[model samples]
Target chain A: DVKVTQSSRYLVKRTGEKVFLECVQDMDHENMFWYRQDPGLGLRLIYFSYDVKMKEKGDIPEGYSVSREKKERFSLILESASTNQTSMYLCASSAGTSGTQETQYFGPGTRLLVL
Target chain B: AQSVSQHNHHVILSEAASLELGCNYSYGGTVNLFWYVQYPGQHLQLLLKYFSGDPLVKGIKGFEAEFIKSKFSFNLRKPSVQWSDTAEYFCAVNALSNYQLIWGAGTKLIIKP
Candidate 1:
């Protein structure tokens, strides 16, 4: 069984504060993703990393950045948190060799509240 | 723009009632369809997926979905839903040539006991 774990399950931060959310996967998957889930808006991708130090922007990547210094860990960084950035953050990983048909395993998600 | 659409946003059904949720995608290429379920506080998990071969695919916990290429639809169905089946269902599509998966807004299903 694959295990994806997040650093925090819930977080609260003041406006303009810097925030970091971490995710780690034990499956050694090469592809990792960061997404923010909001009601009615669905899951909007923030950024994705295909390999160490390799990052790609998704549909919505504004105000957010990601780091993949190691294969097992992926970190999402908010330059300066705003109330609008409050959302449920999700991290997922999939086998890189597999095509788009590969199934992505997800973490439990971190609910961030920007005050 | 390519995207996935789930018709129902919220659905309430009694236990033992038959269930069906509609999902449609707007992509004109070979695609992989998926239905994912998120229980109350649990992480999202794959309910079913359709890549090729059989259009009718069965997944965990007695859930199933059918892919209709002509309609560009992949609708999920269950014979009888239990209270434990209450969850938020999301429809996602992955175009063969694209790395990102287009996702639907999701349907929140509440099963009454």
Candidate 2:
């Protein structure tokens, strides 16, 4: 079985603070993704990394960035956290061998509250 | 633009009732379809997926979904739903060679015991 773990399950931060959410996968997958999930909005991709030091912006990447210094770890960084950024953050990893048909395994989401 | 559409936002049903959730995509080409479920306080999990070969695919928890290429739809179905089946269902699609998956708004299913 594949295991994806997040650094924090719940977090609270003041406005304008810098926040970091970490994710690690044991499956040695080559693709990692960060997404924010909101009610009615579903999951919006923040950023994705295909390889170490390689990153790509998704549909909604404003105010957020990502780091992939290692294959197992991917981190999501909020440059300046705002109340609008308060939502559930999800991290997913997938084996890139199958192209777009690959199934992504997800971690327990980090619910961030920006006050 | 590639997109996914779920017909219902919320669905309330009693236990043992039949279930059917509609999902459609607006992509023209070979695509992969998926239905994911999020139970209360649980991480999102894949319920079923359709890539090719069989149009009808069965998944865990007695859930199944059928892909209709002509209709551009992959609707989830269950003969009988339990109270434990209550969860938020999301439909997603990804076209061939695309890196991102287009997602639907999701349907919150509440099964009454």
Candidate 3:
């Protein structure tokens, strides 16, 4: 079985504060992704990493950045939290080819609030 | 760019009701389809996926989906839904060219007791 764990289930931060959301996957998957899920807007991709130290910007990469220093860990960074950035953040990992195939396993998600 | 669309935003059904949730994608080339469910306060789980062959795919919890290439649709269905089946369903598509997944807005299913 694959397990994806997040550092926090819930978090609260004041505006301008820096915030970090961490995700660790037990499986040695080669791909990891960060997304923010908003009601009505669905899950918008924030960033993704195909391998350690490599990253790609997704559809909604603004106000967020990601780091994958290790194959098992992916970190999402909010340089300065803002009220609008409050949302349910999710992390997922997948193996196999880079595109068009593979099932992604997801973490429980972190609900972040920027006050 | 690839995109996905889910027909219903919210659906209410009594237990034992048959279920069908519509999903469609827009892309010119071959694509992979997936249906994922998220129970209240729980992480997302795969319901079913269609990559190739046997258009109909069955998944955990008795959920299934059919991929219709001509229609560009992949709809999820269940014979008889239970109260525990209540969850938000998301339909996603992956274009063969890239790793990016185009997602639908999602459909919230509520099964009454």
Candidate 4:
């Protein structure tokens, strides 16, 4: 069984504060993703890392950044937390093998509340 | 713009009831479709996927989905649902580029005993 772990299951931050959400996957997957889940909006991707030090912006990348310094860990950074940023954050990882249907394994989400 | 649509937002049924959820994508090219379920206090997990070959694909927990090319639809179904099957279901499409997925708003299913 693949295990994807997140650093925090719940977090609270004030406006203008910096926040970091960490994720680690044990399946040796090469692709990792960050998404924010909001009601009526669905899961909107924030960023994705296909390899170490490589990152791509997703549909909703404003005010967010990501780090992938190692293969097993991926981090999502909130430059300046705001009340609108309060939502559930999810991290997922895939095998990244080409020509194959890769299923993403998700971590227990972190519900962040920005005050 | 590529988008996935799930018509039913909330559904409630009794146990042993047949279940069917509608999912449609707006894209005219080859695509990969998936159905994901998120139980209470759990992360999203794949219930079924449709890539190619046969339109009907079965997945874990006796769940299945059928892909209709002409209609651009991939609807999920189950012959009988249990109380444990109560969860939120999301339909997603991999189109436009890369591994990025376009997700639907999701349907919350509640089963009564």
Top model by DockQ, which number? 1
Ranking by DockQ: 1, 2, 3, 4
Report clash pairs, candidate 2. Answer: none
Q: What DockQ does predicted model 2 obtain?
A: 0.84
lDDT of 2 by residue, B20-98 (tens): 9999999999999999999998889999899999999999999999999999999999999999999999999989977
Model 1 stretches with alpha carbons more than 4 Å out:
none
- Tens-place lDDT digits, model 1, residues B53-113: 9999999999999999999999999999999999999999999987898899999999999
- lDDT tens per residue, model 2, A1-115: 9999999999999999999999999999999999999999889999999999999999999999899999999999999999999999999999989898889899999999999
Q: Per-residue lDDT of A1-115 in model 1, one digit per residue for the tens?
A: 9999999999999999999999999999999999999998778889999999999999999999999999999999999999999999999999898788889999999999999
**Per-residue alpha-carbon lDDT of candidate 4 for residues A1-115, written as tens digits (9 for 90 to 100):** 9999999999999999999999999989999999999987789999999999999999999999999999999999999999999999999999998533678889999999999
The ten-residue window of minimal lDDT in model 4 chain A covers: A96-105
Clashing pairs in 4: none
Which of the CAPRI classes, incorrect, acceptable, medium or high, describes model 2? high
Q: Which stretches of candidate 2 lie over 4 Å from their true place?
A: none
Q: Which stretches of candidate 3 lie over 4 Å from their true place?
A: A97-99
Output the TM-score of candidate 3. 0.97
* Higher-scoring candidate on DockQ, 2 or 3: 2
